[model samples]
Target: MFATATRNFVDEVDRGGLLIPVRSLNDSIALLTVVVSQKGFWFWQKPKHVPTDFTLNDILTGDIPITPVLSETDFIKYNGIYGDSIQGSMDATFIHSNMNAAGKDSSKLELSFGSLKKDEVDVRQLLRDTKNSVLDMSHSLIKQTQKKRQVFGLVKERIVTSQPCSVTEEVQQADQCGGTLGFCGPKSPKVSLKDNGSLSKDSNVTMEIPTNTTIAYALIDLEVKHDGHYELCLMSNKGGFEVDSRTQKGLLGVTGAVSNNPDDVSRLAQELKDLSDHFQLLSALPASSKASLLKIVTDVTEDRAALGALQSVLNRMLVEKSANIADVSEAHKQSIQPVLEMLKESECGSVAETECSASLLSALHLITSALDELTHESLSALRACRSPAVLKITQLLVHCLCESGESPASATNVGVLSEDVLANLEHLFTSSDVNLQRDGDAATIQIKQLQKPGNRPLIMFIALRGLHSLAQGV
Candidate 1:
């Protein structure tokens, strides 16, 4: 359904900039190219009524008079939040109701060829999304800090144990005999959890033992080196598991999906819609139907609906990616011919002046951050980043702030690196790290930092080189 939907839409658009509507998914956008084949369209303006002389091809091809498709069709009704898919044609009156006031009256043609083109990521946002998701998982997999819990027990005095705990949505029971499903015994005191994509972050971002706490957790830690090597370490912690096994029971207690809440199948449908995937079709629907449809999209954990929705999101991302690629390829670099010439100057500004300058530094940091955002994961926006040029353009835009000879008032301050202070400006960087702990001044880093000078405004600079060094190879 995913591949076929794109192919069908692509065949209709050929290679045009217009976004057509489909009754298939919520708030969906389909394109119809000016193709080699031209035929009459079929469209209905009113209930069970066809245009006087209209053919199906005419409606599909947008050849019908604007009156019927716009005002006459139910698709154009201005009700907010939801409605049914109008007749085949876009309610010309409601080309994009989801848009803001500025874009409310804008037609699909306007959206396709509008100022939003810059939003396109040539390397394919979808691919970037995927990559970031993996990194997030990697980061999440990194073992969270499990501090030793101190307690006075009847059997042991002041027992300091590595309290084992797991975050989960629900748990199940084991069907076999001689097994407790939700909770576990001393021998099997580890809980297994699904990788809630969000789980990969600050292992400290924890959930209290909500509802279920009968099961144990199988503690595992994943470490990622700067070189990209990942090591997984598994161990049996000293403390018994802290878990909620209320839903499942057994020696090998059954459990519902543990996490990845954001992209939880239940949540993915809305996310897909946000990204203008097939879920966009829901936009044309009435508020209630749209809600029901979204419910169907989310409540899909083990069924074909889940698989179908996932496939649609992925496929739409790829198509949008390909489309973005074509866009970057066609952009005219010559449009800014003069600026290009300036960059070719024999002697450009000094690296520090250009990179760390009060004006240009923020831009540099922003672009770098954006690059990290782009490079973090392909799943982030497979539809947006389709080509290398896209990321290059993003870099260009970031550097463009500096190249323009005018400093932006607000620049990103990514504080200097500890290592940089260690090497070039040593005592200043680690003074607090080493001596503060010794001196019992844990607040030293706050006292001293990457501050720019007011007298010599031009000399104002953050130790970004420190950050760069720290992030090197990482």
Candidate 2:
């Protein structure tokens, strides 16, 4: 009866259009029986020979070859012999399992490939098509397996604990399956930005950004606009700011999908649009109102939204000169003392710290604008002020000018320094104890010590810019 059942199964497989060799079919049945009955024995023994010719007696007596299929070069050469029949069986099994697990009727399982005209068979094309079909089936099986695991509470924990499964083990499993699955896991979405700071829907950059993190970094290809150079910058709060020239732009883009929830998507879009609207509103404000806004901004210490608003306003004012020079100067005078105190305690913070960096940049802009507006008498008084805070502010202004050359479009308006400011800068240059030397059309300022070690080059670069500004003014 068992032999009759096996013969009936093989006959059914053949009738279903699978042309598995009769010997292979018998061997497969024998191997299945051995696997079911002596599972412990078979689990310990890695089958060296393909099951196509093995029998139950061979498995029971441990007479089967112990060679791995992958180690056999001849198996690869003759792969076409068994590949199609084996793959077809696997594909059918996978589909049936998936449909059954999904609570669908598997009785309707059918293999139809439309009508094929009688013609000379291209063996290579046939193999290629079969390989691709198998791959597609494998991918579908993997996805279904993941879904079933999630549904049945068999999902593996991604996080590590003191229990059985570790991250290392999970990684090893992925590595083992990567060749068959094409990848270890799903990839994240990536978005690119052009040099002009416009986001690109299609870009070559590949990086993943987490769903929860509001801030993301991207590589901007400024080649067309910035002398074929690229830049690395932060993207957050609906704006982008360059980090530094030293930071190369590579491996930048959104790494993951956005939220799938429609409400989350809608809310995010609305927030971004609101930020743009706020910037536009601030930019359109009259000069006097903007000056008042700057004053309010200086008083804001911890509110990120307020800081962003102020930064937007300041950026517009610097770029467009929308505010009156006198009004800006007055606002600068009111805010300069506080900003100077901040500078004394700290060096310029990272561009990532939107509040601190934006505030500092805005204050520097106001000071430069004020210096450009100052009368010679006022400038002389500024030189006479000679305080450490004053010196620090001067150094900060010069640094802004020097760094602005790297990104002229986004830099402060330091190019228009008045003769009065230039003379005062020259006085500060001559009086400073740091080594100051000229090397034919270029000035270098080197400082030996700084309150903050990281700020040494910052001060030196700014002082050098001040010297250059004075030279150009002269």
On TM-score, the candidate that comes out on top is 2
**Residues 148-253 of candidate 2: C-alpha lDDT, one tens digit per residue:** 2211000000110111210000000000111111101012122222222221121121222121111101111110111212221123211111222466642222
In model 2, residue pairs whose N, Cα or C atoms come closer than 3 Å (at least 3 residues apart or on different chains), thus clashing, are 48-66, 48-67, 188-255, 207-255, 208-255, 209-255, 223-228, 398-462, 399-462
TM-score of model 2 vs. true structure: 0.17
Candidate 1 residues 237-294, lDDT tens each? Answer: 1221122257742212111112222212223223222323211222332333222222
lDDT of each: 0.20, 0.25
Which portions of model 2 show Cα errors greater than 4 Å? 1-214, 220-222, 225-297, 321-364, 367-474
User: What lDDT does candidate 2 reach at residue 431?
Assistant: 34
Off by over 4 Å in 1: 2-8, 17-21, 25-474
Question: How do all models score by TM-score?
Answer: 0.14, 0.17
Whose lDDT is greatest here? 2
